[model samples]
Target: MTTNPQETTPNDWDTRSPDVQADQVAAYDAMRSKCPVAHDDYMGYSLLKNADIKYALEHPEIFSNKVSTRHIAVPNGMDAPEHTAFRAVNDKYFTPDRMQVFEPQIRQVVKSLVSKLPRNEVFDAMDGFAQLYAVRIQNVFMGWPASLEQPLIEWVEKNRRATLAGDREQMGKIALEFDGYIRALLDERRGADAAADITAELIQDVIDLPQDLGGPRTMTDEELISLIRNWTVGELSTVSACAGIILAFLAEHPQEQDRLRTSLAVGKTAEIAAAVEEVMRLQDPLVTNRRVTTQPVEIGGRSIPAGAKVTINWASANRDEDAFEDATTYNPHRSQENNLVYGQGLHVCPGAPLARLELRVLMEELLATTDLIEFGGANPTQNAVYPAAGYSKVLTRIS
Candidate 1:
């Protein structure tokens, strides 16, 4: 319960400080030990400890996810009954039956990307495979065209830079640009016969709204666009980050990579998936999620007034020593019951099932295809800053 001097100050820690941006995991680790419930202007109260985060997640009533009044994030920004309805629509696309059918397509996407990589040559895995794999799979899943791939990748990069810069104007412009792309797709769908894909299904999906606002009705174009945007973010950025993180881990940890490769060879899909989860747990892809207090709350021995912004640092919480033994150590068999990799509670990522399936299939193909994976060239790996995780430039050699 050590109180930080900066806790009462305006900005406890600059979330975008050079040191933090350079290595967010280490910065968060330091914060967890020094001030688990730290306050700063950017992210009002950062809950670094596992306990505090778990409390925040379990009690969404106190810590609402409605952090933004400007933007609509589909179910992610909604609460309770409204969230439940929209979430039902969001969840419909990621069902087990859908994933079962989507598995081979995802595998083929991975295989096609991996096959193109030059053996024993130094290449940036993030650019060479991870980003492409993510974008390609997302397009295929959503029934988007191949032409959208490069533009989408460019959009993600610009959006990340704009967000990091805190350039609201640029961010808004970027959002509008993305909306243009999505709206075009939507327009195309509207004019033609209904396509057989998730995007088409979502376009036609209806939700039963409560009597207060409106009854059962179809979502407006704006709502549809917002929902797709949410899904796109999940698919492109988070998935890309996961791919890079998993591949980077495998490249560095040869023994574990070999073990995983062997496991995959023997058709041990579950084991492979567990290893992917563990690796990602050790180095999470998605960084933090925002929640604001609905009422005054006490967390990690710090009193937070009502309406205060709260940031749940998944990067820190997943590795909290209090919640996990040898938290930093990479142990695939460790129990993930308490792991918040995909998060916890009501706002937990609805795309978890799809993400897991994609990662598992990608890893399986990667391991089965390559004999050895190791650091490439002489370039140092460049870690992505806040709002993003994992290596931005992962130079690796696969043969």
Candidate 2:
């Protein structure tokens, strides 16, 4: 199809181009049709189809997770036995029992945020509700003070900007700023109490590292800070994006909204959770995850050399037409066993249970409290640029 330049030369695809940034999902959706794998300067090789992404996830060895040496990303940046040890430490926080115990707090946070929604007024849900929901729940989880709410929110926004601009210096400063916040918390918790909150609880948890590096030792402050940053910064931005996406979808599709509300009334939580997963599959909250090729590899009929960077395009993979029947339509009942919403394999999000619980509780609370959810009709929504997925500004209404 010489109709479009993108179809002719996939490598020329500029992720930072104006059209692509304006609506990433639409751009990626188009990319999947013309090219399954795309390459550009900023994002490296991008996997646009579900099969290719799953292939990479299934074989982490060939596509290594250790994409950078400049900074430590705790488990997200670790690979193999090292990743295993750190991952075990990460997994304990989101266990079934831990999530069960933490459910009420999630409900409380959601209910509190829901109660504050302005009725019959135009408000930006991204800033007013979604970000608040993510920040407050994160605070609840870590026993962080309410004072940190605004700062964390601000930090997330700044982090997004820095990341999109590819300003490594600014990102490094942002990282240190976050580490400072965690360091202060650690100081406050020192000898004050054990397992006071998840952050404090981490003090007692030990990573079963290799014997050469002092096996079974507690994580250092730096390591603890890195892990906590993964838990907080990663959660806040993406969850807020997810909340915005879900709320906007509800606003636009009254039938599905009513269906979910009724399902909530009947205690059809499994249905609601399935709906959330399906919606996320429609519009993924996280964009790309990076990996570096351990050796030269052939993927999707393209030859990629060793140590080359790879960006897994969750936005595209989740929306691939080949992956789901009528992939663009919203249908919760269809099989979603292959959904890459939270990811797959070893690095499959350790915090998924908590994320699911939070979203489920949020939906239950928002729907139960409001008779309807719809657009504010005063302002058009803004789609977030790359490095962030979902709405940047959503005009929402609740009646």
Best by TM-score: 1
lDDT tens digits, residue span 1-399, model 2: 223212233464899999999999999999878877788877778898899999999999998988878778899988988899999989988899989999998898888888988998778898778998999999998898999999998999899999988998999999889888889988888864544787787888989999876788999887888889989988998999989998898888888888988898898888888888888899999998999888888898777777677899988888787888999999999999778988999889888999899988887787899888889875558999988899889988788
TM-score between candidate 2 and the true structure: 0.95
**Structural similarity to truth (TM-score) of each candidate:** 0.96, 0.95
User: How far off is residue 23 in model 2, in Å?
Assistant: 0.5
Off by over 4 Å in 2: 1-10, 193-195
Ten contiguous residues with the weakest lDDT in model 1? 2-11
* Candidate 1 lDDT tens digits, 191-245: 6575677777777888877878687788888899889998897679999998888
Check candidate 2 and list the clashing pairs: none
Residue pairs whose backbone atoms clash in candidate 1: none
